[model samples]
Target: MTDHESAGTPPGTEPAPAADGSPAGPAGRFLARIALGARHLAAGLRHILTTGHQSDEEIRRTLVLRQLEAHDAVRDTAREELDAVRRRITRLELAGAEEGWTPEQRQQVRMLREERRRREAAARDMGRVPFVPVQPTADQIRRARHKGSTVRLLGLLAFLAALSWLLVQRPALLAPAALAALIWLWWSGGHPPVLAQRPVPDRLLARPELDPDAAPAALTAAPGQDDDQDQDTDLRHVTTADEATARIAAALAKRKVHVRSVAPAVRTAYGWQADLTLREGTVADVVAVLRRLDTDFRVGTGRTLAEGSTDDSAIVTLRVLTSDPFANPPAPPVRPPLSCSILDPVSDIVSLDGEPTPLYLAGTSVLAVAVMGGGKSSLVRDLADYVTACRDAVAVDIDPTGRGLGPLRRAALRTAYTPEAAEAELRRLLAEARRRTADLGETEDVWQVTPTTPAIVAFLDEYAQLTPEGKGLAIEVLRIARKARISLVVCTQDATADVMGDAVADVFPIRVLMPCRKADIGVTLWPSAVSEGWTAHHLTPGDDHAPHDAGRCFIWAPGHKRPILRYVPHIAPHDALQRAQERLDAGLPTLTATDGPQAAQAAAQPIVAVMLDAFAAAGAEELTVAELLDALAAVDPGHWTQWDTRPDRLAMGGREIKRALKDAGLPPVPTVRSKLPGRPSAYRLQDLKSALDETG
Candidate 1:
């Protein structure tokens, strides 16, 4: 036998004597044991209350079941033992009453009778184990609170009614009586009532072992349930942590990397996250294995996900895509007009795993590169729509082929269809940037664009076709990206470094790589892009030989971990035109001839000469200032800002021409009286001709 059985002591019951053979202080030893036991008891209670599934509720059910079983076991045992003692007592009584009994027989019968009586008294003296439940149900708690509140309210009402009667019957005695009662009540409740204390149990009370036959009815379920559970089908294949770990191990083993162990998997909002330690592999090796896993597992790339450590461990967060996102796309986001800055997400919302794709266009320049029919122009068109609708931003599109900015023409301040026109527009924008710098004070780095100081966004499609002049203009424009507040969105079919040289390419921090014919284009645009999983070469184009139609591409924007897939929205032509017209009708500022050099030339011409030419062209003898300004604006909108149509203000667009009559050697603008009241400014064509002939 072990030492414990020989000592007649149960395990963990008491500490043994010291080597010196002196008994340890029993009080100190008992107290120490009690403290340790109390700590463990408290910890167990806390775990029961918080750790298990449906912890509080499950704990309640488990405790109730255990209590019922214990009560039944103890009661049944006591009843059976008592019954046996009673039978023995009856036999002793019958023997004592018999005739011709010997003295020894009588003595033996008395001893048996004494023993039976002692056993009966002991059984009666054993106290009962009362059952007290904990954690009342929600309904029980609610009902208790309601009942207590109702009782208090009824008592208060009764006291109030009694006080009213007393006040009417004996007003003099009521105040004193009420004061004395309040004082008594306050004094009684001020000190907490003392509770009688009982000695804590020296040893923890454990429930008696329950008999299987006395188990609670609820514990004895229908026999077929177990068989049903065993036969139930689990379609997920991977249900437990062990199963998921096994799948990951198998995937890694295929790449010749053995997984030593998998950490406890966590269920994230997207999918499961697990840390994997390899027996012999580097982080790069792990990443390569994950890339292979993508073919079968569909996990994100290393740069975007799959973080690794130097200790040959990696954390791969993966989610299996059950269906294609494109096939069942979400409703496209509403297109809001651009405000002070140009940041807006112009695409249907899409997320990686659970992280939504971020597309912010403000405070940055962009470059879009793709082969022909690769949705490059479609992206530009979407951008142009945003730039046009902005109150303080001007949309200037330079599509040398004339087809790119069709829907944007009505909204744009200027649209160029020739290399010379685009070049001239770029030069004018560069000049505006300088002017803005002077206006804002050279010390200020960023242009605080406002109604008066508007931002200029120049969208140049087919950038590869730019002449030397346009290229020079592009370089200058790109140089003032952040400081001057000039944002250029340059797109091209050719993604070669030669087409967008180092100087230009370096400024475009937000590079969009749409589908391209060659994989090398991604490397050309960004050298490290290939390693970052910029796989534009693998993108499948849409049917009818169109590349994604709109928005689909890989975007490498600022602050992203790596390149992410996105689709640019395709705004219908009618919708774009309607929005632009709404802006015009709202009297918001539109693009003017001053936005580009070609339009600025018209402004440089003598205002009076332009006025005379307008009347000559119209073949009119007389015209109003409004008519002349309208004619000039229609002919060259780049040079002329739209006239303010506010009823409270005088016309400002034609004010300059009205003042320029004297400079052209003509009479001052004369006022023509209106039928209602005020005289409006008007000019005569014949007088302007006579004055021009005299000046000549």
Candidate 2:
């Protein structure tokens, strides 16, 4: 009792005796250990069947394998996307080359292609370096250390259990067990646990850098280095003269135009020039097939030219410009000649073939037709510069808008800024021409222009703005002025019948057609000129609102039997002004007897004076605009009659009168209710007198 109490055992509870009624001994303990082992094994089996539990090593290995599989799938998807993009770029390039693309579209495609290339380079980099090393996180390291310790403890326990069982059962087997245990210990000590080793972020195997020899040719070459080589290759493949002729024949044959014989093509700075004798079609048929020829030759639009020969309509001259002929225009003359003769050519223009073509402005009328911003003003300024340089020429500018000839005003003999004043100036010139013709007296068919008797070159800008009567006067001057050494240079936006009457338009032998409407080309030149590759209508404007072919034109002159593309050298405004000032300083010649200050003064009389004279002729204190216009016409038949009786629908005689009065600094005409039937807006004589007095 005393011992049990000291050991802290309950007095009633004690160990049961073994089956032999004896105290539990070593054999009984061993049997109990076996039973405990059996129970533990059964519990493990239950856990396996119910939850499918896995060891940490198996879980980690499975995670690593899944991660590797996912990485491969992502790489494959990226490759597929890159391939799709490459295919799309290829399609766009092929489509663009087959058809045509605008500059903006081409630029967009180029940018897309560049982006695709950059992405492909990134994909290639990823492909080269298949994997990346990843540092383990703190939690991962802790788990790995715990797993390593557990595995070492399990190995030690298994070795001890095997050694004990072998020594008890068979002593001879103990040697083998000890040897196996030593090997296991050595392997466990040398190698790290599976979870403890550093993880590979990507694949285990990585490829090396691509070999230069195995790389694509485009990738191997340096940027822009291949362009020269490609250009050389293209030069080697340039179309020969015979090849060009054959291509031309093939191109024309598709359009049902037969070529009988072709001359050997002559290589020019641009591309080629050849003469062809047609068997079944005229030159128009050849021109009609230019688009097809451009495709066959791998050139751009408006690059081929075809026109009939002067002597033989059956023979056609074909020209093809491989590159843009007008990409770089020739520089204008920095300094024009200070003194020249009217008999000689005024200026030299460059043709498409890079040859200098002379423009003769002495005895013929020139009509320059262009749309707005088509470089018509530049043409006028060029002419003004030429005339200003002439020693035996006096330029008379009639610009209704007043801005066309503003820069060369100092060089002009007399400038008219209004339709009325222009009409008056033209009338005075007509009188002078008649006097000169009478003085000739059949001695000479043409007047001899000299420094003393200078030729008169009338520059009329915006001819469409002129009244019908003014236009009629201009035509009359054009008809009789050439014999008297007088020439007209008319510039207008269009040459439609309504804009420039066919009667006057036909008389202009030298026609310059700039970029304009398709119909304008036909109206400005002969009907056949449009069919002869006179492609002024195809010219378009650039982003700056100026024509792409600004100074380029198709000129139809008497010397040029067929239309030819020519570029008029632009004359800067400052240069024109400087030249004109120099000519003025040198004392330019004046017109004959009829072009002195008196005639100019009469022609340029103030509007207020004219209005006052009209008021006086009406013999009334106040008169309506219509009445004033009628009176003004009666007072000055040459200047004011055109306003009242202009045949066009733009006949605004009353409005013109009102503007004239207002322009003279007179108050607005008030509507007066008189005893007459219609109470119309009228101007008073008192107001005109006051304005005239104030101006004086």
TM match of model 2 to true structure: 0.52
Q: Kindly list the per-residue Cα lDDT of model 2 for residues 83-151, writing each as its tens digit.
A: 676556555544543343468755766676567667757776765554332334457645755665567
For 165-194, candidate 1 gives per-residue lDDT tens digits of 988899898779877855543443223222
TM-score for each prediction? 0.46, 0.52
Clashing residue pairs found in predicted model 2: none
Q: Which residues of candidate 1, in runs, are more than 4 Å off?
A: 1-245, 257-322, 326-330, 335-349, 353-363, 517-525, 545-550, 591-696
Model 1 vs truth, CA RMSD: 33.8
Residue 190, candidate 2: Cα error in Å is 99
